[model samples]
Target: MDNLTHSLVGALIGQTGLKRKTGLNIPALIIGANLPDVDAACFFWLEGVEHLGFRRGITHGPPAWLLLPLVLAGMLWGFDRWQAKRGKRPEGRVPVHFGWLYLLGFIACLTHPALDWLNVYGIRLLEPFSSQWFYGDTLFIIDVWLWGLMGFATWWSLRQEKRGETWRKTGRQALALALVYIGVNGAISTYVASSAQAANPQATQVIASPLPVTSWDREVLLKVDYGYWAHVESSARQDLARPNKISVSPCRLSTATAGANSQLDAFLFWSRALIAERAEDGSVILRDARFYDPRARDRFSLALPDVECEPLAPPSP
Candidate 1:
């Protein structure tokens, strides 16, 4: 999920009665929520698809989940002390406690991966221990509906806080509602994927990715023996059994274990539904069917000259 969503979730978590636990509660929540994204710094040194392989890895792993919050909490605790020493601390700021700060950070950090897992872009929950990727495929990376829900809830809770009314329950209710929304979406994803599998009995794998702006519409990708199949199916459509459009392409998986370049290697590594084609000049062109777009050709693709391309017949005049 995007940082905004992460930050909002952190804020909501803090407002759910955690903020009163520590002086730097909000900081711990918000910072911890986005802490796993420290892996994004890989982009600074790594180039292109290298980021893909490095990101959502170590930082999002089980060990990091346990330790990153401690790091963030320590920093926040130090910052507060430094502010006090410099006499720049706010007058209304409450005394900070290390334990409460760590707890808040931990709670916020935990939510980061959970929300990330809900999206199509996979997360490495067991990163250092295992490089396996897990996908919920329940929601889009950035769901406007979620933004609205979290935004409205945060705003309303703040208003209640200012009015000196009990606002903790408001935040709790918002979190409950958000959980319900995610649960419903998860069920829908499972239904859509099952329906697609039923339609294509030969499909080895069925990935049902939720489409933005639709509650029950999904772009289903199926890996068949021949190549791959893609279609857009909607549960709300009159014909739930039929997909809106079905596109099938025939190609073989690349024999090369590694890509010609880091970019291609990273893309291939991250791609779940990979498609490959033999180019005319004995090059291998690879694409991830998940991001397949005819109009925006080669957007999520890489060309490898070193990888052998299957022989093709010459065109007759």
Candidate 2:
């Protein structure tokens, strides 16, 4: 989910009876939502040091979350102590059920990677012990559907509850909707994996994802790069991988243009290093260029805002 969605979720979660304070639970939700990205900090480009996928290491690992509760509890305790000394109570302290509050933070933080894994991108769920990346290729990084379904539902439900409506009713309905989305996408991913296997039973196959765009809608891409030449299945409604894969090895975003052969080269210039790729036939392939994709291409792949193109160099004179 994007920052806005995250903020909204935090706010909604704040409305819980568990959160008696005005601002305490909201901050927890926000922190929990973003806590996973902390791994990005480890990606320090240096003059002497080499490059490494920081998140695929400790940050995305299962064991790394083991300390999440302890860290959160300590922070809350320190805050409570500070408030006592000042004789001015803090605005957002979880007065009761410290254990449950800490637990929620841990789960919120964990959700980041769990959702991240659903996308075609790589994540190291079990790090230190292994560096092999596992990608569910489940959903798009910043899908609007997830925002509306989870964050939006949470907000509306909370709002209704505030006005003496039934929070339980709305929350249950929201949960059911969310589960359906997850289940449908999960089934879709399996179908994609099967399609890849049928393509080359002799080869070892690994399925990537069906990035969620809405409650039950998603964009799925399957990459068969493990064997000889790499191929991709950029399917919408469960299309299979074709033999002829787009061979834009080490491509750049600057190459995106209609009827151009610089397909591979153009994607490289974009934030491929920071996002997922959804390749379509030579026609186009969409990626989550959050830091660079100005139009939020996730909205509509072909709707990306135009950027001035540098002419491909003329043939040698």
Candidate 3:
């Protein structure tokens, strides 16, 4: 998920009565929510495509989940002490409790992975121990509706805070609403995916990803013995039995091995379901059916001429 979503969730967590537990708890929550993204720094040193292999890897794994929050808590604790010693601490600063801050940080950090797991982009939750990627296929990377829910709850909470009303209920309510939305979407994705797969008995694997902005729309990717295919259909349609539109040509794998390259490797590693189509010039074009956009077919695709693949036959006139 996006950093803004993570931060907003962190703030919501803080508003759930955790903020009053210790000084700098808000910072712990917000920072810990975004700390797993520290892996993004690899973009500077790692070239194009390499970052894909690296991002959402170790930092999001179990070890980091346990340790990163502690690191954040320690930093917040140290900063508070530093401020106190310099006599620069704010007069209203609450007595800092290191353990409570760590707890808050850990709780905030846990939310990061849970929310991230709600999106199509996969995360390696058990990294180091395992490199397997897990996908929720529940929501888009960014959902304005979710933003509205969290944002409105935040705004309402702040309003009540000014009036000195119990604002924790608002945060808790928002969290509950978000969970319900996620549960509904998960059910929809599951039903749609099953329907799509049942529609094509030949399809060996099916990945149904919910589309953004709409609740019942889904982008379905299918893996056949020969190649991959994709389509978008509405779960809200009365007739899910209606024929699907195959949005792109099936990318057929060649008899020869597609040559290995960094770009192709990274794309293959990240793609959940895809196909390899041979170009006329003996090159191979790998497209992830999951992200195939009719308007931008080339996007999320990798073309490798160096990788040797069986040459495609001349076009049938």
Best by TM-score: 1
The positional error of residue 233 in candidate 2, measured at the CA in angstroms, is 6.2
Among residues 3 or more apart in sequence or in different chains, the pairs in candidate 3 whose N, CA or C atoms overlap within 3 Å are: 259-307
Best-fitting candidate, scored by lDDT: 1
lDDT of 1 by residue, 32-125 (tens): 9999999887868986556766778888888988899999989999999999999999999888999999988888888998988997779889
Residue 134 error for model 1, in Å? 0.8
In candidate 3, what are the lDDT values of residues 1-317, reduced to their tens digit?
Answer: 88989998999997788899999988998999999999989988977566767889899988998899889988989999999999999989799999998898898888888888887778988999999999998988888888999999988998898899999999999989998988998988888889877876777777877777885687776654454354546556635444354544344454354345566667767877665666777667776666666564565677777665543333221
- TM-score ranking from best to worst? 1, 3, 2
Per-prediction TM-score, please?
0.91, 0.64, 0.90
If both were scored by lDDT, which would come out higher, candidate 1 or candidate 2? 1
Off by over 4 Å in 2: 1-23, 44-52, 90-97, 199-243, 247-317
Provide the overall lDDT of each model, using Cα atoms, as 2-decimal numbers: 0.80, 0.51, 0.78
Off by over 4 Å in 3: 237-259, 279-282, 294-299, 311-317
- lDDT at 208, model 1: 83
TM-score of 3: 0.90
What's the distance in Å from true for residue 114, model 2? 1.6
Error of 2 at 162 (Å): 2.3
